[model samples]
Target: MTAPLHWKLVIDTTDAQTLADFWAAALGYEVEDQSRLIAQLLSSGDLPEAAVTEHDGRRAFRGLAAVRHPEDPYDAFTGIGAGRRLLFQDVPEPKTVKNRLHIDVHAEPDGRDDLVARLETLGATRLREVNQGPAGHWWVMLDPEGNEFCVA
Candidate 1:
């Protein structure tokens, strides 16, 4: 039998850094810090100045940014996380339809509204509330790029 596998949720976005920032805040995750590696690349002439970008007022990797659980083990040199992560990669076009796979944000009932409000402030738009009788209800929302998610 095969063992369990580990994976990350990869998202395509036009502005990777921005999306990373939002999701990081929403999930209380840490942005993977790769400045050290980038600096080495720059000094070794393996990377150009144009390969870096300013994000959240700090130097960050260009074209892609990722956020990981704060407590996750990671490779300090490469900034690769070993736990839950969301990697935002650059794409040419925007999202045009509902996501076939969507994440459901689950929080304590007392904190659900606050969490939803916080997500809204971070660029998520509330689509509508869904109540499934006994199974419970959730709020359908769209991310900054229009991908669907639920806050419950």
Candidate 2:
């Protein structure tokens, strides 16, 4: 039999912390708080001082940041989520092509518009309206880095 597997959705970004912050607010998730480990590593030279940076006045890994479902169980040592998570890792290339896979955020029937508006205020851009006839409708939007997602 196959062993159990778990995963997180990871995206390449120019600024990991900012993207993590945007998604944390947009999804109502919390930024993974890994400062304690970072401080320990920095002090012991396990991690170089340059390997960490500050975001929102808190220390964070320089190239990566993540958000986790608020209610998800997480490792206190690494501050990593055991359930749903989204990780942003820094990359040099810009996003030039459309996404072949994307995230769709579902909400209460009456909450779509308000949620879309809220995301826009967080730096998401409206792409277009997708109407699927009898299936339903959803708003396609781009994140601050131009990554596409849907509010349905």
Candidate 3:
């Protein structure tokens, strides 16, 4: 039998921490706390001061942040998720093309509208509403940095 590979979705953004926070709140996930790891690396002179930033009053990597499913296991020392996770990394260039991949958020049918509204309040923008006559109905939304995702 073949073994399944573990993976996390990585997204490029202009502001990693901001996007990570938005995704964490939108998906009911938790932002990975790497303060301890950052401190350890800094103390060891392995990570430079320029590579660090502060988020929510805690040390974080300057151009990186991540969110993970609350129930997932993770490395205690490094604060890296071992299961479902999303990593956001900063890139110099702006997104110029439509995404080849996107995330679809499934909500209770009765609560989808509320969920969309809540996402909007979290800095997501409603791009459009998509209805497929019976297959499904969903809202196409853009995250704070304009990455596309769906609320279904």
Candidate 4:
């Protein structure tokens, strides 16, 4: 028998909190809070002081933040998530090249042009317009943090 898949996408970021906020606003998801994990790590002294940080005046784990689909299942206390989600994990370096794998959003009603406008308002900028003869039209757009996605 074929195996059932289990998955979520993780994106690397220098600032997890900021990236989480940006992605949540853009995708209409809520940020996952991992305060308990932070607390446990801090109290046990397993985490170094340098690995914890204050962002906007609140203590946060320096490495990660996540956003999940509103209707999707998540553990109430820890926010371990299931369903459409993007996890942003902090890294010291910046993203240096184009994404090898990216998302393509299909337009529901009036089509690609209309979807492009909505995405623009959400801080995605158009990269290029591609016309696929019989297949359809698409726009290559970049998210606020420069990750690419297609509107088609």
Candidate 5:
């Protein structure tokens, strides 16, 4: 057990910042702030202006954005999370098929309906409700960019 390796789930999207914002709100996480790092790279000519964009009034890499658990440890200089995190990166192609892996959001007991509604308000589209006798109940949903996830 070579000390568990650190990892993050990377998602591809046409708009990384927008997806990151949606996920941050949905998961009660915080968006990583890399404005200071971006500024330093830009000033050093290591980063091109076209590769940056404004997100929440702060400079961000145009092709990348991420969200992490609010209490997770992160590198202050780069704003990169060292714990549970999700990185959204821009991709040229659109999602063409179902996801082989998806996130499952488990709500508090008896709070599934409310959670589903809240997620919808945040841009998730409910595809269908599923109820398997004794197996449990859940809602299959799609994120803003059509990524599949479930709420239970």
Candidate 6:
């Protein structure tokens, strides 16, 4: 039998909440909140008080947050599985180099340039422009965090 295919992508970040917020707003997705589980555990005495951590002047459950396409399916209770999703996991160190894999977004006919401009307004910077064989063109850009993505 073939294994089930999963459709989620993950990124490492020093601040998962910040990344979650940026991506949620940029992609029109909602941030996943696991605090309900954390709170339930705390109230049921199943989790230690130390399990929760403060982040960015807000209380975070510690470790992970994600954003997903609004129309994509995901479990509301667990916020797990089945979506075009971006997950940000907390790490002690910051990203120091270019990403080996990144995302590219395609826009509607005649809408790419406008999309690029809008993205720039949102803190993405154009890195370069390229024109290839037979009328193909694209712009390489970097996100606020320096991750690269192409607009075409």
Stretches > 4 Å off in candidate 6:
1-3, 46-59, 133-135
lDDT by residue for model 2 over 1-152, one digit each (tens)?
Answer: 99788999999999999999999998899999999999999888899988999998889999899999999999998898999999999998999999988999997878999999999999999999999988989999999999999989
Candidate 3: which stretches are off by over 4 Å? none
- The TM-score ranking, best first, is 3, 5, 2, 1, 4, 6
lDDT of 6 by residue, 73-96 (tens): 878766654678898887787778
lDDT of 2: 0.94
TM-score between model 1 and native: 0.92
TM-score of 2: 0.95
Model 1: residues with Cα > 4 Å off, grouped in runs: none
Model 2, residue 44: displacement in angstroms? 1.5
Q: Which stretches of candidate 5 lie over 4 Å from their true place?
A: none
lDDT of 1 by residue, 66-110 (tens): 999999899989898999999999888878877888888898767
Q: What are the root-mean-square deviations of the candidates from the true structure over C-alphas? A: 1.4, 1.2, 0.7, 2.4, 0.7, 2.7
Clashing pairs in 2: none
Q: Which residue runs does candidate 4 get wrong by more than 4 Å?
A: 54-58
- For 7-84, candidate 3 gives per-residue lDDT tens digits of 999999999999999999999999999999999999999999999999999999999999999999999999999999
TM-score of each: 0.92, 0.95, 0.98, 0.81, 0.98, 0.80
Clashes by residue pair, model 3: none
